[model samples]
Target: MSPTTKNAGGDRAGGLRGELTPRRITALAAAVIALVFVFENTKEVEIRLLIPEVTMPLWLALLAVGVVGVLCGVLLVRRRG
Candidate 1:
């Protein structure tokens, strides 16, 4: 009935207690990135800039893009409320 209390099976073997925190998600992402970088076995994709076209290693490009995305997200969230 209350927030602190759990009903029958609420805290069972397969309960929602195993929620993924931000730290866990970040660590998992880092591990996956490391694995991909080491393997370098991803499908090929082309990148086009304003002036020229370039071919790059997929995993390195993805990590770079992801870093940019994280920076933008942080800037947006940190803006005045």
Candidate 2:
């Protein structure tokens, strides 16, 4: 191999900038879709918490649930790995 083509410190030529694999692309797409789904729901919704009911924007509720789901996934992965 030519010296000009050799990577510095044995790192890839483009480093992480060239590492956008199919899995990263799919994850980006999923995040965009999830954001759209959450924002599209702008109507007010009533949520029942055992004995009390509360009203809030649907988007807020959806976003909160999404955050919780992501947190749970992260926790599970950390626990197992």
Candidate 3:
């Protein structure tokens, strides 16, 4: 019956619908679909660098790339500091 309680209820309802415009939803959906191809089950594949061939499981390759990216970001930040 309190005025503050009514205001809080209205705010919660608004939040459930989200605050994003239609454009944000389309962009997010496209990004997720694109990543689906990157993580989908794939057999070991060979990547050729220079004159050498490196064979690795698709998932392992993805994990290594992600870790390398994080390390690079950290190094860059430390160097900047």
Best by lDDT: 2
Q: What is the C-alpha RMSD of each candidate to the true structure, in Å?
A: 9.6, 4.7, 7.9
The residue-by-residue lDDT of candidate 1 on 1-81, one tens digit each, is 678898766666674458798978997998688767745746666888788888876766777777787789888889684
RMSD of 2: 4.7
Q: Which lDDT tens digits does candidate 3 get at residues 1-81?
A: 865666635665655376778888886886577467557846798988689999987867776776687689778878541
Instruction: State how far residue 71 of model 1 sits from its true place (Å).
Output: 0.2
Report the lDDT tens digits of candidate 2 across residue range 2-81.
76675555655455666789988998999999999999999999998799999999999999999999999888878541
Rank by lDDT (best first) = 2, 1, 3
lDDT of 3: 0.72
Best by TM-score: 2
Residue 21 lDDT in candidate 2: 97
Which segments of model 1 are wrong by more than 4 Å? 1-44, 79-81
lDDT (0-100) at residue 64 of candidate 3?
71
**Which run of 10 residues does model 3 get worst, by summed lDDT?**
7-16
Model 2 scores a TM of: 0.74
After the best TM-score superposition of candidate 1, give how far the Cα of residue 36 lies from its true spot, in angstroms.
5.8
lDDT of each: 0.75, 0.89, 0.72
